[model samples]
Structures are given as C-alpha cells and as structure tokens.
Target: MSRATVLACLVSSSVLALTVAAASPAQAAGVDYVALGDSYSSGVGAPGQSGLCLRSNYSYAAQWATRNSPATFQFLACSGAETDDVLDSQVPAMKSGADLVSITIGGNDAGFAPTVLTCLTSSDATCTAKVNEGKAYVANTLPGKLNATYTAIRNKAPGAKVVVLSYPNIFDTSAALCEMSMTKRKAINSGAQTLDDMIKARATAFGFTFADVRGNFTGHGVCAARPYLNGLTIIPPQNSYHPNANGYTLGYLPALTSAVS
Candidate 1:
C-alpha cells in the first residue's frame, strides 16, 4: 500500500480503538450505598431541597454516588446528628443489601459551631482547655459509639464495605483570617486533627476504612482560597467554617472511589 494510504488506515484504526474503549462497560458494577451522618453529609449549604428532615442533593455523599452511575444510593444522613443519633436513626434506615456505607459524625457531639464560637470569644487558656476537653470527650466516647454503630451496621448489612469519614479543618491558623487569634486557631486545628486521628485509628482497629478528608483539606480550612472554604462568612450571616461544595468534591470523591473500588 502507498505510505499515505497506510498512514490514513492507521489513523482510522486508532479512532476505532478509542471508540471501542469508550463504549466498554465500567470497571465495576453499581453499588447499593448507604450514607449516614450530619449536616455535612446532608449538604446544608449547596443549592438543593432544604427541608427539615430530608435535605437532598449537593451533599458530598449524594455527589459521590451520582458520579458512580448505575449505583443505587440511600442517604440517611441528617443535620445535627450526634453519635447516638447515628446509632438510633441511621442504623434503622439502612437496608440489608447495601454494598457500600459512608458516615460523617461526631460534630454535634462536640457542639461544633458553639464550641468554635466559645473558643473564638474566650481567652487563650480557656479556649485551649475547652478544646482539650472536647478532644478528650471524643477520644473517650467515639470508639464505643462507632463500635456499636458498626456492629449494628454489620448485623443489618453484612456485605457492605463501611467507610467512616473524618472531619476537615474548619479553623485556619494563618493570620490572614481575623476570626480567631493564630494561637486559638492553631489549637482548634490541632484538636480537629486529633479527632481525625482517633477516628482513623478506631476505624482501622475495627477493620473498617477511614476516609481522611481532614488531611485532604490542608491549607484549605475556613480561610482557604476560593472554592475550598467560603471565607469566614461561609454560613451566610455567620462566619464561614465548613467545607464548601468544591471542597467536598475535592476531598470526598477520591475517597469514595477508593472505598468502592
């Protein structure tokens, strides 16, 4: 064949190969997912249905589920859910055939926003002490709580791969954000990290997976660059302290992929 004709044939072959690859089925089948947690899991800020009990869409869990098409998802997460609440409410809502489960809890147990406000308003020593106390509470309480919750989950859905999510850094220590002093901000950040570590350790000990969104959110706490966290006023009329949609997308999707894969 002529060199020009040969080149054209090769090009056509390459295009056909690409098309075939694209048309192939995905690596894995759809999962029966159950999401359990608090407001973060409920997608409080992102645009969606904002009902009292069922705040749907824009949530990290929902977003993650949506990205993995053909997957059937059941989101049982709620706002203001404490650890006990997960045991009580979420466990009952879970189905027997769940293939994957993800949970983000413990914030309300620590009274997250109120704690932050208290630290922001208190003296350094007082704030440090309070944060320390909160950390101790989590360390002491979470293991048992998580164990019970996981046990119930296993009983209800034996085949599911359970994943526990760690909280992100909501307080930035850098001097750029004026909401709290650098020292206090550092304390809060350190406390949050400690909580995450505890959660990871417990999850590992219990043979469950830990999704470290905390580490993924480095330098992108409450005062991070645009899209990670919404400045100090992210809550709208309140200071910005939670992960925005972009932050959730960045920190959550990879973890979800790993959990299911």
Candidate 2:
C-alpha cells in the first residue's frame, strides 16, 4: 500500500477506537432490560405520559433504565392491565435471556381498584362487604393468577434477574380515610397486605426478587402528612391512588436498586 493509504487506515482505526472508548461500561456488557406490568409500572402519575398507554419517562422502569443505561430497554407495561394482560401481551415484547426485568401487578387481578371504588362510592355496610370480598379474592384467586404470570415471565426471560414489586396500602390502617370509613379502610389495607404476601411468595417460587414498598409508603400513605400517592383525584379520576413522582423516583427506585444489586 502507498504511504497515503497507510495514513488513512491509521486515522480510521483511531476514530473507531475513540468511539468504542466513549461507550459506557454497561454498554460493553450488553444488557437487555424489559419492564413489564400494570399502571404502577407504566407511571400514570409520574408525568410525561406517552400515547394512550400512559407510559412516563419518570417511571420506575424508565428511571432504572436511565440509571443503569442498558444496551436496550423495552417498556411494555400498560395502565389498567391485569395479570392476564401481562401474560398475553407484555411478555410478547421481551427477548429471550433478558438481563434485568421489573414488574408490578396483581392489584387489578384481585379486584383492588374496583374494591377501592366500592369503598369510595358505597354505604358503610356495603363497603365492608366489598372489602371482605376483595380479601377473599386475594386469598383464594390472586395467587394462582400471579403464579401463571411469573412463570410466563421466567419462560420468556430465562436468564433475567426479575424483580417483582408489591403494591403499597393506599390508606393508613389507623385513620379514617378521605372517602371511606375507618372500618372499611382497615379492611382494604389488610387486603393489600394479603395481596403483597401472595406476590412475594410467587416471586420467591420463581427465584425472582420481591421489592415491597409497604414500609416506604407507611408514614406517607394516602392520609399521611405528605402523601406520595394521589388521594381521590376527582378531575382525572383514573389517576386516583397511583403514586406521584416521588413514589417512583424516591420510593420504588431505591427498592428496585437494592434488589438488582
């Protein structure tokens, strides 16, 4: 080769080397992260929602992906999605051997949102009955559903480090909530505990990490001095009970970081 051709080759090699050196260490390892689940994962109240799916850039999955800077990140979780929706829809978006996965589900499957609605819209006696009904669903039905979902996720991402997140109780157990009686609030919170326990067991069975935020949201519940979750969002009712920015950023993100590390 001529001297000019040798110089050109050297410049090309050096440029490629610089480009590779600029890439992050995480990128060198080739991480593929897939975030899947329901409203909480989709980031309903965390702001910058996209499309009708209600995905937010401030979502736990988004935050985690940003901090971790994966090679590729797929956000498939949707608002109001149940365990079945995740099995049928969300898991399809994942690639095999995902490096990291995060999910929050089972609340809708246990009729939690509708049960909370009953407490907000019913008489005290009827609210108690509905809360009890939700409790039964948690104990009798929600587990099997969670197992199917967790199993499906494992099958899809066999090598993934899956992090299963549990829902926090919306109300403080000791207080009379904004719209529901204290008796009804206590029952509903108990049901949430039951739901979390079921999810924890399912995650453990699959060898997945369970990140419980019940303690994090305890003093900052729906009726707390400075609440993280929305309380009775009347103008945009769909946002009710979902976490604000702090809940995902300060609350869920820390728990998830601990699990994955």
Candidate 3:
C-alpha cells in the first residue's frame, strides 16, 4: 500500500507504535519518522504536492528527511488540516516503533486564514470582531482539543519523540499594502502570538519539544528586506500567506534541525 493510504486509512486505531520497537538500531539507517500537520508543515507555498497527502518534498519535514536520511520517512501533512483532523485521522501515522514525529497545527482551529481574508474583504471593525471570535476559540476551545490530540499521539506512539512546531509571525508591522489595513495586520499578528503561545504550552506540557520559528522569520515576514511569506497573489491563490521556499529552507529547516539534536 502507498504510504499515504497506510497513514490515513489502512492503519487501525488499535495499533500502537507498530514498527518502532523492532527497529534495528545497529544499522546505519535511523528510526522511522513521520510528519503530520497543516499547510505550514505541508509546504503549501512551496512547489506543488507530489502525493495525495498534500505534501511537498521541499517541505521542512522532507528536507529534514533528506538531511538526516532516516531509515524510513512519511510526509503525511495535509493542507487545511485542523487539530481535530489530526486527532481523528492523522494519528494512524503515529504507528508503533516510530522514532520521531513533528507537526504544525492549531492555526486552522483559530480560523487564522479566514480571519485574514475577512479583514481584506470587509471593514477593520468587522474583521476584528471575526478575529476576536477566532482568538477566543484558540484560548478556550483549542487547549482541550490540543491536549487530547497530543495525548493521543503520545499514547499511539509511545516510543517516538514528538516535536510540535510553531508558526511564524507572517506579517511585518512596517509594511504598507493596498490589500488590507495596518490594524488588521497587527491584529493578525496578535492572533499569531496567542496561537503560538498556546501551542507551545500544550506541547511542552505533553513532553514534546516545541520548535519556535518566530526568530527565523523576524525580519523576513510579509514585509521585510525580503519576505519569507507570500503576499496576496492572483496567480496561485492557494499558496497565499504561506511561507515560500526560502522560508522553509532557511527559516523552518534550521530551527527544526537545531531542536531535534
């Protein structure tokens, strides 16, 4: 069966970390590793996906696989996935005997992208109202959902070292744009802080290493000398607001690598 099928369909919930226990450590190859998350982890702004999982080989997880040369690697991150999606379905990939796991979720739960769009399409006050709803969701609803998902991952893959990754502050306060107002940009960044902090706290609470990439995207946000994130574009609407190749390579990859070893 294809890797995506195995991760999303074939594996039963009853199966714990299946392959992780018998892994031959004496071999030169490393342990079985799996990547799971939303658009950020799926490389939505990179080149198109090569599989049904919405995973691009240029993603940070794929890059990490190339650099580390793990015994086996599965890039199962799908774009638009929320915390519930991972908890309900993606947990199948956290098979027994798996060695390492990394994920970037919670933004979708916070209605992040939609809030940004609401700001663009409507009034600043209207946008803030919607964004506030999302923020409240993150604060109140997301924690319990995140904890359940994190705990499921730990239970499903007891042997694996889970690494929960953070999203960057996609906006640059200094930038001026016709697409939206500065107030919305700042509001979105404020929401980003809330999401990141919550994810960080929940991740560390579950004993997973939370990799923060805010530092990497510091000056390279949507407005900088050179932006790591994409601005509104008509050419490819799907990749909008996500990290481009440079962001994945220079920003996320370095941070993820350092966090692992």
Candidate 4:
C-alpha cells in the first residue's frame, strides 16, 4: 500500500473510531490468541478439518498455537465469512481479553470467488467485466467494511496485537500455459492486489500490523512449480482458489510468526 492510500484509510478509520465510545485497553495477560475471518483464515483447502466452517488444524492460526502453546486459541474463522458475518457472528464469540488476534478478510466482500469462477467458465469480456466489478468493490466499498470490522475487533480485543494478514495473488501470470487466458489471469491478479491493498490500508489505520504474503507466495501461485493455493476443483468446489495445507504452514505461518515476533 502507498503512503497516500494508507493515509486515506487512517483518516477514515479515525473518523469511525471517533463516533464510538473509546474502549479500554485489554488488561488480561498470558498468551490468549484468537483467529477470525473467512476461508483463508479458516483453512478451507487444507486437510484435517471438518464441519461447515472447515476449521483446520493446519491453519496458520492453529499451527501457531500448536507451536507456541497459547493459553487459549479459538479458531473461529468460517469458510464463506464476509465482514458482516465477522461483526454479527464471529466477534460476539471471541474472548474479550485476547492478547493476540489475526484475521484475513475482505475478499468475500469483493466477490472474488464468484469473479474467478466467471473467468474460468465465461468469455474473456465477461471475465474482464467481473474482475473490474471486484476491483471497484475493493477500491470503493471494501475500506468502509474493513473499517467497521477492524473497529469491532479493536473494541473486542483492545490490547491485542492484531495482525491483519493479506490474501496472495492467486495466479502466476508468468506461467507458460495456464487454464485461464493470460488476460484473465492478469486481471484477476490485479483485482487481488486491489483487495489486499484495501485490507492493508484499513488494518494499518487501526494501528494493526499488515502482513503482506504476496512476496512469500511468489513463484507459488496456482500455476507455479510448487503451488500453495488450490486451483479449480469439481468435487469440492469450495476448495477452489484457497491455499493448500502447505500455504498455511509455509506461506501464511511464517508471515504471521514474523509479524508477531
């Protein structure tokens, strides 16, 4: 994210925060961590998970808890969560005095999954239009949604070091021959960048750390030599475009660890 964009998001968040009664800093001690967000945080494509939420032990949140042995580690992220879902459902269930919180959100709000499906199953023009739609949502609407979500999180876990992790670009445009056309791939990746930028801006505005995973995911997208994210799938459609177990363990875990450490 650029300085100007970050400044814009900060101004937005500051205005929103001013409207609400200020929350007290969390006084609770010990390692009490909570994970909240959508499928990317919930570990949709990773194995060893169950139920509609698909909470996986292989998720970066779970993996971090396992390695560090926090006093409490609640993996509350669901597969298809939007920002509203986090505010109305997930945040209510979170422990109030959490010392650490991590989230990956905004993609579903931008309608990224459906956009990708359009690219895969529709014409180039249709794909481009859908990608443009997602970009617009990310650029214009997602910041407000993220601000609300981040505000709720700050209220819920005031002292927690909130690490807002970003989504990686799903495709490697450099791939010689991929399933989607080069144009579609580049467009989709561009949209993903827009979404990540919005998320980063808002997260930073709230004084939270923004973990950019795109660098770690380089050469490891859908069509790369060692893909961390899953490509399209038929039997289990929800798994499509989500990170594989390796992505959480390798791509996401290291990012979170570095951010918090």
Candidate 5:
C-alpha cells in the first residue's frame, strides 16, 4: 500500500477505537464493589439462591455487578444478618480499595420478622401492638446499632461510596381486595417507614448516601395487583415479606444504580 493511504487507514482505526471506548458503560472504570447487609440484600424471596445466606444472582448487588462488570464483587450479605453479624462477618471481607459498597440492614435487628408474622396471624389490635414494639426499638435503640455498623464499614472500605438502602413498606393499604386487615397493613407499613427514616438519618450522619426503595415500590407492595414483595409463603417461610425477583430487578436495582451513578 502507498504510505499516504496506510496513514489515513491507521488514523481512522484509532478514532473508531477511541469512540468505542468512550461509549462503554461507566462501570468499565474497574470498580471493586462489595454487597453487605441482610436478607433483602441477599435476595431471600428471589430465585437463584443457595446455602444458608440465600445469595441470588437476581439480587440487586449481583445484577449491578453483572451489568457494570466491576473489577471485583463480594456478595457477603446473609438472610438473617443483623448489625452485629455485619460487624463480625460481612465487613471483615471488605478491603480498603473498594470503590463501592451497598447494604440493607436494620430490619432483622428491629425484629420486623416476628412483628410481621404476628400481624399476619393475629388480630388487628395484636398486630398494632407488635408493630408499636418494633417502632419503639427503632426509635430508641436501632440508631446506636446502625452507627456501629456504618462506622465499621467506613473504616474497612474508606474510599468506597457506601449506599445504605432502605426497606419498602410491606403492604398496600389502598388495595380494594386484600386478605390482610387494613389496620394491620397500615401498622406494619408505618413501622417500616419509621425504620427507613431512622436509617436515612444515620446514613446521612455518616456522610453516606441513603437509597430509599420505598418510592420505587410505592404501588407495588404485598397487596398490589403486581406486588414486588412477597406476602407470605409456608414452604420457604424466610421469603415472607421480602422482595420478589421483580422487586430486586425493578425496585432495588435502579435505586442502587442511581445512588452510585
């Protein structure tokens, strides 16, 4: 080939390569992302799960990692983890060079599991009492526990942009035809809101970003026509009140992506 023709071809090739590289997804920057927290983060209700932790490829964390193609990803969140569990087990796996970290904790710690169970199987008054108990714990005690967990995360992954995710209100009180009493549903949702508010405050105090999934999940609670969260299931009882696969894909995935991006 003539020298002039060869030089022109080389220039075009270089320009094409640069354009393709520039158009790549933001995650191509080699992010080291860690997913830490409890059942919600572990994808309990969603499918593609295994072992005691119930880690699912469908979980928001896994989906995010898959789409972004991060340099490294550790899905350490477990089904029944509390703040203490995070401090003792999950946080230990996190390293200093991590570029991103996401968590969904405090629900199990506030005893939402048993509270919801009570609401599902008991009278409206009884459900209200149990929900009140959870609210009391959230108001008076969960802050300290959350603070400890958040602090440990900051220390472990100093450079990571931590996104603290909040839980969705479990029920749709507005649903016209539903089995759960409106009173019970409202009480349970109120408890979740209280917990979320507290979590947002603590996350902000730590200078971490708080991703509220409630807005994404507003019309998609348990009683909705297309519910993202599971109502109750006897076979795998742990899945109860947790987000379904759609919830992770639609409700949570976007929330985390928005927070990090």
Candidate 6:
C-alpha cells in the first residue's frame, strides 16, 4: 500500500481499538451502588434523624455496601413508599453506570399500618377477613410494579446486579406485650409470607436476586426470640411497629450481605 494509505489504516485501527476498550464493562475495581425501597430500606424507626434524612447508619443496604468499602454508594430509599412510588419517585433517582442495585418495597402497598389497625380493632373473624383483603392487595398489585421497576433499572444501568429484598414478619401476637390475638398475628404473618413469595417469584423471572428475609426471620419475628420488631407502645421509642437498630444489625444486614456477595 502507499505510505499515506498505510498511515491512515494504522490510525483507524488504533482509534477503533481504543473505542472498543472504552466500551468494555468496567472491572469490579469498585462498584457504584444505588439503593431503592420503602421504610425498611430507608431505616425507619432506627436511631437517626427521620424525614428527608431517612437513611440510618444501621440500614442493611448501607451496612452491606460499607462493609465492602471503596464502593460508590447512593442510597435513595424513602419511608411510606408503595409500588407506584418506586416507579415514580425512586426509579428516577437511580443513575446510569450503577454496578449494583438493591431494593426493598411493597410493604406499604396494602397499607400495612391500616390493615394492622383493623386487625387490632376487630374480633378474630373480622380480623381474618381484613387480613385476606390485605393479602389480595399485595398479590394483585405489587408484582407488576416490581417488574416494571426492575425493568427500568435494567434499562438505565444494564450491567448492574439487582437484588430485591422481602419483608420480614412484623407481628407476634403470642407475646405478652402483643395486644393482638395470636390468630390475628398468624393471619398477618401468613400474608407477609405470601407477599414475600410474590416478590421472590417476580424477581427471579426478571433475573434479579431475591433476598428472603422473611424465611430468615421465622422464629425471630416480632413475637419470637427477643422480638426483632418493636410492638405498639413497646420499650423502644422510635416507632410502634418497626425493626429496631439491633434488628437491622442482626437480621437484615447479614441476609443482604449474603445476597450481594
């Protein structure tokens, strides 16, 4: 080839190689993580300032990410989030190039507090009916919302590994401190389990990892062991029915770490 043509060809090859290298998946030198979810992921009732400063030092996602430090962490979780909220509010907070993503949502989709209040107010039969209604709300509404949220995340940051965490059983009616009846608590827990199952199934279909915190919290649920969750008018002052800092530390953080690892 002529000298000029050979020079041009060499320059073109170098530029093409550089472009391909730049487009390659960034090595795991460190991960850029974005966390999305509801109260549980927001660290509600944990020892920290609430409101816009929703994140706490003990949050499982934060703890897990920090444990593997040097990671670029952006936690955009909020309290009182429902399925629609994740799509409308949280999804936009995610940025491109996130290498890892974690989400915990759907607890508030069925209006968990109101459902619990109904159970607390009613007799066993009425409480059972209300619990069934709550179950139906979760089963019918949450899966599609979760799927959409995951799909959106995949589109924004195609290389990230996503993990969706399920809610833990929050009622323990058998405890002396638990004012609600055991039957009502059992029904509520059953509904929580059903919700967890739905999240797991949907996350699996989307190729995201499912963290089964429900199963991990079995005996340690609100009433069992030492009451992982605070009860209405309980010792901890943060909230009536949410996980304590210790609960986040012992229960949720470990499970989250396992899923991410």
**Stretches of candidate 4 exceeding 4 Å from the true structure:** 1-29
Tell how far residue 24 is off in model 4, in angstroms. Answer: 29
Residues 3-61, candidate 4: write the lDDT tens digits. 34433322221100112111222322257889999888988878876887878888888
Model 2 TM-score, 2 decimals: 0.86
Q: Kindly state the number of residue pairs that clash in model 2.
A: 0
Flag clash pairs in model 2. Answer: none
Residue by residue across 3-27, what tens digits does model 2's lDDT show?
3443332222110011111224464
Off by over 4 Å in 5: 1-28
Error of 5 at 42 (Å): 0.5
lDDT score, candidate 4, position 86: 97
lDDT of 6 by residue, 7-61 (tens): 3322221100111111112333377878888778878657773556367766877
The per-prediction CA RMSD against the true structure, in angstroms, equals: 15.4, 15.9, 9.1, 11.3, 16.0, 18.4
**Candidate 3 lDDT:** 0.77
Q: Pick the candidate with the highest lDDT.
A: 5
lDDT of each: 0.67, 0.77, 0.77, 0.81, 0.83, 0.70
RMSD of 6: 18.4
Clashes of each: 4, 0, 11, 0, 0, 0
Off-target runs (Cα >4 Å) in candidate 6 are 1-29, 173-177, 234-238
> Largest TM-score belongs to which candidate?
5
Per-model TM-score on C-alpha atoms: 0.82, 0.86, 0.86, 0.88, 0.89, 0.82
Q: Model 1 over residues 1-261: C-alpha lDDT tens digits? A: 443443332222110011111111254245677888877677654456366533556677777665565357788888767778888888888877787888887766765665665675578898888888888888888678767877887788888788888888776555475667777888888888877887788778868888877666676676555435544442232213555666666765556656656
- Give a tens-digit lDDT track for model 3, residues 1-261: 433332222111101111211223343176688888988999877786655555777788888787667888877788888888898878875566678899999988788766766776678899878878988998899999899889888888898989998999878888675356788877888889988999999999888999999998998888676888877644445567788888888778877777776
- Badly placed stretches (over 4 Å) of model 1 are 1-29, 54-56, 231-240
Question: For residues 39-130, what per-residue lDDT tens digits would candidate 5 score against the true structure?
Answer: 89998888878987879998989888877788888889998888999999988878677888999999888887677667766899999999
